[model samples]
Target: MLNHYRIMLVLCSSVLTLVGCTNEKAFERTQVEGVVTLDGAPVEQGVITFIPAGKGATAGANIESGKFVIPKEKGPSPGDYRVEIDSSVPTGNKILDTDGETMVDEYANAIPPKFNRLTELKVTLKNGNNQHLFDLEKE
Candidate 1:
């Protein structure tokens, strides 16, 4: 009985030590949120992406809206990205008017327009919350 008790105590201590070591370090967390706009108007739909700052950084995507949010589990990092917006698609349609009057009817394409440089804003994230309001305009 004495020997069995000693073995159980040793096992319990080892388990406790392993569990404590597992939680030795905690990862820092950061968050980012902001609104995206163009020409003082809200951009309907767009895609927002994050590229990690340092070498071999990870990437994430958040769709475009009036607002966007990104969670940084790996703490704060630096990176460069190009934000883009999809403009309304262009559809080719022609209509004619009668009685000496000319009328033309047009429709937007089923596909949304794609802007390559809408989200091309450079930003940095440090220790806390980082917010950005992007107001893009056509050149």
Candidate 2:
């Protein structure tokens, strides 16, 4: 009976230590960078958000000169990531002519004008300095 108790205690301790090690490795922060290009041209003046694969912390960067560099944050768990843009423009009443100021179609909707669909780019971030370039196409 004493031998059985010792075996059980050892197994429980080993399992707990393994779980803690895995969690620490997962939540570690890392640097990530990338560029966004549309039709072979770098996208300028846009926000690129990185929504992680699961409940991981999100990160992003602002596009400049067709390039972007994400700040050091918690790295992803090595998987696919869906990319979306908050591409919305405000329609002001400061119109020049009636023809130019008309909301003919669904332009009045609150939905932002999507330059590209969500999930257009699937970025895979690893454990080191991650460099990626996304090229978009018209559907």
Candidate 3:
């Protein structure tokens, strides 16, 4: 009788352990993809960041040829976020580096402040995939 009870207890413990080890994430994340365009032209290369409005993880992705994709594994949790997109263009000039060791190409942000520093862009990410298109205009 004691041996049977011990076996039952071991089985129950095993089941509990398995349940605890099941594939479950502590926080949920959703995939996000989008395109970034400036004045009707695709951005060649840039970076897009999502700053959570509330308590959540911030996510970002690289924009390549006007497309950006944040996979579900590295996506942000469902919430409101402030979007920031930035791209730089070479000024066709070279200047001395701050390190005072080499010359560096001068570059400037192609996107306006309205899309980054003083951004007016906002997005709400849901439980599923999210897609967005940003057509920014220069002021």
Provide TM-scores for the models: 0.54, 0.55, 0.83
Ten-residue stretch with the least lDDT total in model 3: 19-28
Per-residue alpha-carbon lDDT of model 1 for 59-93, expressed as tens digits? 34444556777777643344333344344433567
Quote the RMSD, in angstroms, for model 2: 9.7
Selected candidate, larger lDDT, 1 vs 2: 2
- Deviating ranges (above 4 Å) for candidate 2: 1-26, 74-78, 86-117
Write the residue-wise lDDT of candidate 2 on 23-84 in tens digits.
45455555667777766767655767777766565666667766777656544444456665
Expressed as tens digits, the lDDT of each residue in 11-73 for candidate 3 is: 999999988875664557899999999999999999999999897778899999999999998
Q: Which portions of model 3 miss their true places by more than 4 Å?
A: 1-12, 15-26
Task: List per-prediction Cα lDDT, in the order shown.
Answer: 0.56, 0.61, 0.92
Ranking by TM-score: 3, 2, 1
**Clashing pairs in model 2, backbone N/Cα/C closer than 3 A:** none
RMSD vs true structure, all candidates = 9.4, 9.7, 3.2
The numbered model that scores best in TM-score is 3
